[model samples]
Target: MFSTVYDVIVVGGGHAGAEAAAASANLGAKTLLITMNLQNIAQMSCNPAMGGIAKGQIVREIDALGGYSAIVTDKTAIQFKMLNKSKGPAMWSPRAQSDRMRFSETWRNMLEQTDNLDFYQEMVTGLLFEDDIIIGVKTALGIEIKSKTVIITAGTFLNGLIHIGNKTFGGGRAGESAATGITEDLVKKGFESGRMKTGTPPRVDSRSLDFSKMIEQPGDVNPEKFSYLKTTTALKEQRSCYMSYTSLDVHNLLREGFDRSPMFNGRIKSVGPRYCPSIEDKIDRFASKERHQIFVEPEGWNTIEIYVNGFSTSLPEDVQDKALRKVAGFENVKFLRYGYAIEYDYFPPTQLTKTLETKLITNLYFAGQINGTTGYEEAAAQGLIAGINAALKVQNKAPFVLKRNEAYIGVLIDDLIIKGTEEPYRMFTSRAEYRTLLRQDNADLRLTPMAYKLGLASKERMDRVVEKQEKTDLFVKFLKETSVKPEEINPILEANNSARISQSMKLFKIAARPQLNFNDIQKINSVASFITENNLDNEVIEQTEIHVKYAGYIEKEKNQADKLNRLENVPIPANFNYEKVKSLSIEARQKLTKIQPETISQASRISGVSPSDVSVLLVYMGR
Candidate 1:
């Protein structure tokens, strides 16, 4: 019954798929989102939270690029936090605890309202291909849907197998059935694939827990939102999360199910996420630790269902209950559902190009768990990039690819294509070397302009970025040009434990002091009046302050990035013959041939390719 040739068809409706559909359609393409169940769109499969550490920066970047993630998060947030407030602005990250039901509902509502987008409920069984290029998808019911481009964001659903102790079932999620045919079809088409495992924590009944015994973790007194746009407001009457610990007794009780544990007993062969290991994995890895922390978080504004964070396990239900009961605040906890681990097929990301399009198939792209990444933020970022690039390819335009120095999304895609993660990949601040320039506060300044040049970001979003840039620039200039008299600044400096200046100094210079801040400096009459007259908000003032404070460091990073980008400009032909470069090591040759890096900078980043190999390639290219 599907006769129309859609511009783009996105398979799976998780965070990644949703963004892909929204992005492609927002770019004026006729797009269709096919999910196994429309009700579960944008489901929070693990935690009921968004944006933490590096992931938060990614959400902001997505929003700056006109993606809907940050807006949806802000609309549904029940609690808000700016994590790592004590650290530098580069470390600062915005996080939100979302109402799970509302998060899903918001996504569906936005998608329905979005123009040029359509929705369907169907399991994509196989891809329709002509030669090596993808043409469309075939559903389980044998309905063939035609599309010019396809983005597969099938998160943990390809031949997925769930395990809880000895019980095993074929399911994508806890209750959803596993998707078939696609993985086998792809493998037969000469694509390499492997297995990965990820687990979730049990959902406990909030009424059953004893919160009085646990420490309450409250949200920010003055909460902030994820969106740069004013679509969402700050949360009021936030719900507090509780922190509890798992004692030695709880560990010993959990260990009782070691013999039945699928992870330990070899039932699960794939590696799980190293950063977010399960409770049993933690106990096994960190035996010296007497207790592990557990966070008890509320599921939503209305529900009594609580998420037992930091207690993810795939142990038997009896053992899970027994161990959980021993925790200080969960003495009589009742499980809404037992946690389980699921193993699913994933293609090694090295097979994909920097634009996230498959080298083997034209107009076909992969994002999210299908590319072996974990976390909703990571998936969503990938989806946005993939969606943008896919639409660009369809329209016969230049492919959009972020660089390592520009954004975290850039580092993520570069890392995946170059390093090719052995286990499930998750974003960390350490992963981006130029993180100082990639702060959450300046995501719009970095990406929105680029996105505007493309058709993806709206004129309103572009105008906001322009205004913010103009305001920040003016504020910085004011700080640099305005001088503070010793009498105007000495009292503030003395209060902050800084030496009082004997003479007048520029406000920018005073702000550069380690102990001083913009808030204290703003108390000066001239500075305060200047801010008021310019209509500068906290965001603009903060941006100006950070720029003045970290100008030297930011310049140094930019210089380094520019130096490396010179190497990046040295293009390598797609069909370059690495075999002819006999001076290269055998391992380097094989890796270079397999990865087929687009630039010399990318070649240098590959694991086996050494500096000597790069030198040889440089010489060869020069010749």
Candidate 2:
């Protein structure tokens, strides 16, 4: 029997639940985090790494919004690499290969150290609801703890069914038991749910692979970190990942098991991530290709366990071993664990508000795979938002929602609530219309202020953001004012085969040229002295160069975002009858009524609501 009523109760201690608890407790909420297995807190159940492509941006945004993901990742990272560095700053993303056990331990330590947070290990069997609102949760042991709000980050545990080859069993993961009752309870309480599938590649012993047969993929020479806080430092020592290719012979060997593959044998009824397909799916889909790449990634500095990236399969164990050994470097590959595909329950995210609170169940929120998202960063982002809003609700404060132009988190939640994914939702840079504005380098500049106001981000974070902004502004001003004479810049320009300027050019203009980057610009005496005089770090210089180079694109994207935001400002009445809008398409009306969008902008983004439909909604809003 609990003596105190918690302000927030988080179910399942994965990335999402962990973040939700931290955010709520940090915002002054009396929070309790309950998990079936405390030992698996923030488990990297899939890959032993964090941050990739747009997921990296989400991790940085989570850090800016006062979440523990990036901090923990930095502390446990064995290797660091900034992906897409050859591209523009907008494309640059930070990725780290973490020591698996260390990452989980770091997360647990961070949670335990957080004030106002308590931990409980129990399977939350069902939610305790009063009428249509959440009040608490019931454990499998029949303990009912009271809470003002509940966030379900159950991950892939609800009625989970795992498939390996022709074999199927009830399980959330390899050895983890499936969580029952909660999904059924939710459905009975008027929540709709669906199923989705995701899988992890086999883990092999590193000693079994031949490194000479694969290409070495080393970490970046100048590795960048995920967290914006100065407390975490970059990795000095790094581990190398090896890239090996699977030949046609390997594909043929895998093809021999297509008859037994759960994915191909019609055993998996749900959809999996289209981009991250299993090896069997890949071979079948791209039959013309002779080979596919597989990454041999080290799980930790001390462990010999290797993650076999891009070889996810639900084929027979014998077939998996046979196909794996055919790969260039995996000739003597020994499996630590065979790959598996799991089918789990997920609620249609469209049933939730932008705050991640279910529209049908007051104070009952959803995050992680329960909301149909598939990455740790995505789950953590949703958890941060849900936790902040849940705590703010208890405090009688207005809800916090980020605009799409501000962060990828915003785009992700917006996409889910409006469009609703039929398959597992994964983040990509292309998904963000204003990716240039939402660059990884500017996550703190975009989100830390709002987080600080909510008391989630610390004052130290706020101070750092302020300092970075001030210095970046001053540096940009200096670049604009200082002119580079032909004698001072032409030689450098000529060496790079760029058009030589006859007249004096502003330092900003010279820096903006396509062929010139910060490295190239640093060659100028004035630029070098200005950087040295200001004692500017690489971060500040990086920010300055991006601003100078992408000024036009950034401005254009901002203008477009502004246009959409205007529609966002147009409010729709909560009880507005869509049936009365005769001019609206039947599909639009149905979507509007079902989703009950709060803003014309949100309605515009709905799948069935078109430009014409948005026009009608705007007219109804007196726009």
Candidate 3:
């Protein structure tokens, strides 16, 4: 083997690249990670937060699979909140406000410490392809490094262009140079590519704000960390965020810059995230609304810097200052950095397989922003799955595929590989049908054994998981076997706003009521004693509660997933000419032929492929 030939070579050390390199290296692959700037590895380019909604579940899933995102976030996190606490377990997500500087440093430190991982700070300008297969990368300095497999997680850096008002620049990020060569080369290779844009809100000095003028948003009383690793958080001491809103005055000032706005003036033809729109888009879309929420998030414990969320703008800096001043507490705010919009190149993910490997290039894979995803957590989850599959590929092992029923990661990949997003894809709870079985609290329960079998999860982690499962099983049995008399459980039932117990009932039966919870049962001294005697960890206790309470729904979703799985299992041969089937729509035939979906279920979900088209496909497949 050549001196520099590595088992895996990962380019662009952003969130996705960092996780991918770490996972591949941790799985015993001799991996080399290359990036333009090592100092910015894992930087929070947009927000100083780790997760939100379905994104948090992705972070937890990455952790369960032995990826480093959750571990780093937990270490540098300043404020932690479990979002959607009032909702069902399926809806619960753990998010953390992170120290931007510390988060990057933590990732650097972790990468430095990991075995079999090497780092190089340089820009990759091209890939070396021989006989239609990617053999390695060519750096800007004209260095050719060979590797068995290459994972590209370039984030928003590939052919990146920034737009601020009417001004435009060629840079990956603020003060950073954009990567060249790769996009032109890929396009020449017949890869279909498109432009997508995403924007970040400005950062302001927190010292200039008057706290009394804004509403304080506090962290969860008992903030939970993301990793299953035993790490203690300083519970009593927590940071507080403030909430403000954009007033009509602010909107009016922002409108003055509309004529010069890149998004409105047609400078940016790329589609931006619909859920996270620029201030100008909001004003134009919701013209009558008096105000929109603005979250004033702290950058770190020691820094006066704060991220102005929900106030993303691509207006001129002077215009941004004028509008921001109109917000109640930010009247005297000083800008630390101006917000701008970035446009980057991304291959529609349908160009890749469910394993994230490129369909055109053998042993070459893509992950993170390269696949048009938006958030750090989403990128990290993709990185982990990609890394695992890459390592398995090297070992000649069976491909590791997570079903949509098993994880949000699975759903995410399936969606990307099947539907191919035009805009930056983000995670949402509503996207997962089997969400009840994919709760954040039970990520380790759902994935640890698989990780252990893949040799990614540590034996110690597996042992702890097994112990937790045993305890959870025992506790679930207790709930099923133990019964309470009507006199014993009625008061507790009434307190939780549930129907009064009519007679003796099994603990599982009462806990299954939507209003009643296992915590209510725990409050009962007798039941509390039974739980304490089992010596269960809090995670197990929580998981067991969710399992018992949502057993019926979980089972139903599982069955639904199983029914879908039959179609998922029915493989459609690649290169099957949809045009041969005369009954299919011309549009359907073209889309089906282009996407070349591997299964009937996947073909059904693609845009423009209707129910009738799917039926035609099914008959053609002899299903």
Candidate 4:
């Protein structure tokens, strides 16, 4: 029997729930985490990987904000890669291939070690609400649990329906049962909900494959980690992944199952991820392409199971096996399980405020797939923000919100709340207009101080950030003050194909050339001695170099961000009635009224609201 009321109750135990529970408890709230299976905590349900492209930047941001995702990732990674190495620092992303089992176990251990947190294994059936305000949850056995605030991070589990070829079943995942009651109850309570579909590739026995026929994809020669914390261990030995291609023969073999494929036969009505489409969908969409790339990734260090990445399907088991055999290195492939598609219930994010709390219900918040978002990184970011805001609400403190220019987390939440997603939302670097200011290398610089003030990020983390900043500033100042003659600089510059300087110039100016780098400049005796005396780390030196190299672009982006922040400062009263404003367009009024945007800037971003509408609202606000 549940008697005492908790400060926060978090539902589901995937990436989002884990962070939510950790954040709420670490911030001094008594939190309870309820899940159907505790052993599957933070399970990498799809791929045994984290941090790709924009997702990588988000993980670092999470780490900087006192979230545990990046630390866990570093602890369990089997391979590390910094993607887009050829591109600028703003575009570089750190990714890792994790040992799936270790990833989950690490998360479980972390949750158990956290203070003010309790875990319960139960399927939350419904919410406990009083007059449109959520107070707690109800389990399947009808036991009532009370809480001041509740965060539902139920990922791909609510009313989940799985499809394998023509066969269908009620399940959240391959071996897990579907969760019910909550989605139905929420809909009855006037919350808008819809269905979304996502799928995973089949797992195959690694020994059955021919490695010689596939191309090897190795980890970075010099790898970097995700965590800003110093306690995490760096990877010493990394496993290699392989690349194979699906040929025309494989496509022809797959098309034979079109009649029974769940996707094509109309069994699945919901939309899947647009960017990471199923193989069958890919073949159909790009008929002109000769072959599709398949990434063969290992599941774990000890396990022989391999994930057939890029081969997601809902075709019959026989069709899946036969088609996989046609791939270059999978001539004798054996499947551990056939790939399947699952459709689950999600609420439109527009129904929620920027803090992730529902507009219709007080103390009720939604994160992860429940908010129509895809990817573990996206889910984790939402959970941290929601958890932080939930605790602040309980303390009667102002809600903590991040600006778009500050963190990718801000951009994600803003996009969801402002322009509600029709398809599952995934983050991309292109989404951030001021990406140069939002680079992965500088996530700690952007968010740690704010997080430290919130009591989520610790003093130690803040101190580390301060130390790094000070060292970087001194290094930059040194470069600007020190003059290097042509005799000292020409040898390095000429070797790097940079034009030789005619006279003595500041080292900062020469380092800014496209071909020259900090490492090359450090060859100067005085510069190397300065670095050694300061005991500066590679990251600090690198940060200083990037700042000087991209100074122009960085300042330009900052000015633009400042201009936008002006409109952001003009707050629109929460109780403002758009209908009373006679000059507003009908569509703008309707959208503005429905969204109830918190600021003039948010109102400007809404689809139907125009610049003229924003001007009218600004004038109405007496700006």
Number of backbone collisions per candidate, in order? 0, 0, 0, 0
Encode model 3's per-residue lDDT on 350-402: one tens digit a residue: 99998999998888899998899999888888888888778778878898889
- Per-residue lDDT of 303-375 in model 1, one digit per residue for the tens? 9999999999999999999999999988888899999999999999999999999988888999999899999
Which is the winner by lDDT between candidate 2 and candidate 4?
Answer: 4
Query: Candidate 4: deviation at residue 121, Å?
Result: 0.3
lDDT of 1 at 583: 96
Better of 2 and 3 by TM-score: 2
Off by over 4 Å in 1: none
Model 3 steric clash pairs: none
lDDT of 4 at 208: 96
Angstrom error of the Cα, residue 413, model 2: value is 0.2
The TM-score measured for candidate 2 stands at 0.99
Worst 10 residues of 1 by lDDT: 228-237
Off by over 4 Å in 4: none
Worst 10-residue lDDT window, candidate 2: 614-623
TM-score (all chains, Cα) for each model: 0.99, 0.99, 0.97, 0.99
lDDT of 2: 0.92
| Order of quality (TM-score) | 1, 4, 2, 3
Model 3: lDDT equals: 0.89
Q: Candidate 4: lDDT over CA atoms?
A: 0.94
Candidate 3 lDDT for residue 352: 94
